[model samples]
Target: MRRPPMISLFTGAMGLDLGFERVGFELRLTLDINKFVCETIRANRPDIPIICNDIRRVSTDDILRKAGLGVGGPVVITGGPPCQAYSTAGKRRSVNDTRPSRGGDLVFEFLRVIREAKPQFFVFENVTGLLSAAIRHISFYERMRKKEHEIPPDARLGTAFEKILEEFISTGYRVKWSVLNAADYGVPQARKRLFIVGSRDGVDIPFPPPPTHGRPDSLDVIMGRKKPWLTLKDAIWDLRNRRDLEYLPFPSWGKYLKYVPPGGSWVDIPRELQREAMGGAFYSQGGRRGFYRRLSWDKPSPTLVTSPTMKATCLCHPDQDRPLSVEEYARIQCFPDDWKFVGTTQEKYKMIGEAVPPPLAFAVAKCIMKAVKEDPGNPYSDPHLKFNF
Candidate 1:
């Protein structure tokens, strides 16, 4: 069983890389554009080479040099490109915005690195929004401004997944993709992400490891087949007495959060107060469940966002009126107790929030390792053998 080395790009906080490292994958090099995140990596994992440069400017040769490996070496590459463009919360701009070359477009750079590195296996992770977001020539507002008559069919282009699959297949890899929830892999948050695993050697591309924990009424849990999901209390109960844990000052929204009960949100606020707290969004349609929401000790947390104190998406502590502390954020992301973050409170929160949960990444890595080691032959050789998950 050969353990492959890994090159991690967009390595925010090194959370994903940490998971791989736990499962015996060697961390050879880490790349990230954020200097603060690079410092954080250096502050924690000093032995791994850190390349704090933009991925667009990085070449395959540069990465190979840093990793001390030759081309076509046995290696696994992992990264989650910026996902804001494809995020459902915002306007889905596939490729038209032209702001820093557009959102979701950075996956191209990820692919470029993969092709250049020519790794044996690779893992690509991102928010679920990547599945349906289509490449666009312009924003909807811009299209309205143009007053374009008879919009052509090509105006809306291939979906992000379609484009990604095309590229992966063209690169001579067998690809398998699935949407995985972090809580299912023992993370204390219900963070859902899309994972694409590809193998260059015709190996059966593996899916996520099976769920070890599930919601109370989930079929597996109901049948006594899996453990119940871990909760906020499970992840942060010990920190309750640890006053030294660093935290950002509660946002103004904390006032309204006081009215929110465990497992509650802005709706828990008095109607009159809701108007004052939520302002114009109070009248907006749809459930604004995230606003001033408090964590429920019994349930897995909502997806951890970049800012726990933001008015629109608060992660108020289960018992306290404040947002989750930076230490709590790291714990929920499955980062070890001694793993330190570098920067101001807000910067630290951003780094932790953007990270892939270490537990989930470990599960994915185990699947990849099994596939590469036990099933290196093409899936077509045994059509009955498929990714059951």
Candidate 2:
């Protein structure tokens, strides 16, 4: 059987799309609103068509025309819409975010394209925070003053996701979703993301693809049920001495990062200097582990944020005093060495940090391919399987 063609939306850095391509999916067209992101895509994969405009302004007709497909085309649509609004790392604005770029509503736009394009299958990826996001956000101060019961249903955890699932279901697709860790798929990073797969023909997509990697001491690894997790040493040890390394200069507190041992953070500094290194953040709540943090050679990295030098989310190199280089960021995200990102250093980092690790995407694409190939003609045995979470 011919592999299905693919159309990608919000194709930041083409990481997910590249994975599908590796699995023999022909990437028909790609779309994104960011100029630099589109430029990066064109720079590396010039043969693929692109729609570089706001998804809201780009109609279903435009997408279909660019991909040369009619409605109900044998295509797989995949994307990770901008996830900041639903991200736990942020203020959890949820669907109420009113940024000029229409942050959260982009998910709905993804749904719109799915509804109109009617592809054979579609894959939606986002931060795992989507699972617990409320449709309406209530500030922490306001919530503290009010009883739990006083909060409206819209403000309740998971309400936003419930609505999203309902929207997918309403489009007549059989949907399956799960939160998957990239490290489980051998990406050398423990980035956990939410993935939703749907079939328009009512075929149940087998999801939560079995993990192929695990912690060294885990039962799965010890018993040879899975390979040991890949680590930073496995991903970037060769590049340690590379002359072309590109990275951001560390912040003011970076002077203290040298005292932090590999795998350690703010707490590792001397007690007397900890206050000075952390400053006002010293009194902040929550684990400020990212402060003065240094990477460990033996472990899978913590999730890659857009900026590795932020006081609250630092991703210092294990031995080097500076932040992880842009090349290192690409390596951790599993981008091919030759893949070119066309933008400023910061833009490159943002693209790499936000990408869905290709290894994880390949695993998902393979799972979907296996299901489709094994039972192409049959409807799903049970279309009502609740989401795997």
Candidate 3:
């Protein structure tokens, strides 16, 4: 009759832990390597236990002992170690990339706690790029055409993910994983991430509810009702008063923001600056869209990155020229207004953009609570669970 003991959040960043918190689950403990992030957590939710250290160094004993929970008591684990190493964006560099592949090693640390704490369910999130053909190399298509099955398992998402799932299954948990786009769930952004869910029972986990907003016609589908997806206008319309201060409002936003028009970019810049800004990239083939790109008020936003201050991954305001502000970034990512982020402004942007959208997390948590609240023997089920695009 008692509820699951608690959710032990690892790689807990910004509002991601808070997402689980919104669903009526008590945050017994939260962990992340960034001191500023822990500061943020402590600032906003002081009652929750937050361990601000590398997950690699923290043991399950530390979590259990710190939270005062008994061994084997019900505990749900959630978090995503630094996923850059496994990211599809960077060259399929292995350990040499150094931007946190070792962070991926911390996944093992998460599994270690699973063996000890035995939570009912947990979710592992990562970039969809990791699942791409890039895992073979930049020349992946070439290499495949040329033939090479010898790719290392850790180098790719499909293979590496299977291993991650297998480890959980071996530990007596049923697992399911799917790539989900945040916009589909109404986050006002086009963020796509991989969600891996596992249950202690062998019940195959279910996919997230289908998207609320229909897919774009250009992408696929006929008149899929549901008003046009949210646009940049819809996202940051209220932040216009700061126009003079708008040019690249921060260290990075200034340069890129100057060139990107409300619905324009490098193409809109003076021809000389265009050549200067692009360098040889101008001559390169393909739709160099990201460079000096403008936002469309009629469409959802592109994936929110850790640094909106950076122009290269521009999510420029539709009418305004500056990069999305920290608060604007949070709104697009679906964080509630009251959800305060700890740390400096830049850190605030990073944590919020890097988080799982609160609504998406809410959906996932509701699914998790089903297993926690229902009969584990029935696998996982919920009657009041809400589903949206």
Candidate 4:
């Protein structure tokens, strides 16, 4: 069967598109605002048509023309819009974020194209924080007040997600969404993301795609059906001795990292030096596990951030004193060894960090293809399925 053409938005590094392509989906056009990301895409897949303009300025007509498609075309649309506004790691401003540079409202641009192009299928991806985001952000201090209950429903938890879903539903698509961990899908990271899959024809896509890998002691692994989760050692051990590896130097506070054991963090620092290492963060209540954190050979990595040198989200190498190298980042994200990334080292890191891991994307594409091919007479029928893990 000829697979439907795919038009990708926010196509950073083409990690997601690569996975779709591996599953036989032909990518027709890719779009993104970042110049470096566009260069990377071109450097790797020069044949693909790419739009480097911001999505807000790029009309649906332009997208359709570039993809060589018409209204209601049998095409699949996929994108992970700018997610910082909904990311827990950042200020959860939701739709209230108006910074043009940040593009917090770009999710609506995605919705606009979906409505205009009327693609047969669409996949929306974002950080897991989207599930709990409020349309109007309530600061932690405000929430601590005795009158917090007086806050309007629109300002309460999950309102932002509800509003997003309403917008998608209004476009006449049957949507099914779930939170999935990339490790469960065989990616060597414990990243969890939200995926919303929709069908214009009301065909329900079977979701929470079955796990291909599990914890070493999990039932599925014990039963000999699923493989054990891929580990940091499995992903980047070969690159350890490479002399040409590129990585950022640690910040001054990272001097304390030497005392941190593999898989440990600031908590492992000597009691006398812990306060000096963490500074004000030492008084912070949360686990603060990312501080001076070192990857463990036996475990999957923590989610890759834009930079490994940040004080709060360090991605230090297990045995080495330095951060994970650029090559190691690509490996953990399942980018092929030959994949060419454009721009400076930091640009490459940002692109790789923001990408959906290819292995996880491949798993999703496989399930989506299965749904597209199967008879729709008896669909999965569940309108919403949330995975527990």
Best of the two (2, 3) by lDDT: 2
Q: What is the descending TM-score order? A: 2, 4, 1, 3
Q: Please give, for residues 100-173, the per-residue lDDT of candidate 2 as tens digits.
A: 35388888899999999998889999999899999999886787788879989899889999998899889888
lDDT of 4 by residue, 1-389 (tens): 45668899999999899999987788999999999999999999999999999898888998999888888764589999978888888567888886765556888989999999998789889998888889998886686673757887878988899999899888889888889999999899999999999988876677769888999999889999899999999999988899899888997877898999999988899999999999999998884878898989999999999989998989999999999989999999999999999989999899999999998898888777666656343233223433332
* lDDT value, residue 144 of candidate 4: 61
Q: What are the per-model C-alpha RMSD values against the true structure?
A: 4.1, 3.9, 4.2, 4.1
Candidate 1, residue 208: Cα displacement in angstroms equals 3.0
lDDT of each: 0.81, 0.87, 0.65, 0.87
Per-residue lDDT of 150 in model 3: 60
Model 1 accuracy (lDDT, Cα):
0.81
lDDT at 20, model 3: 68
For candidate 4, the per-residue lDDT at 148 reads: 53
| Location of the lowest summed lDDT over 10 successive residues in candidate 3 | 244-253
The per-prediction tally of clashing pairs is 0, 0, 9, 0
Residue 179 local lDDT, model 4:
90
Question: Which residue pairs clash in candidate 2?
Answer: none
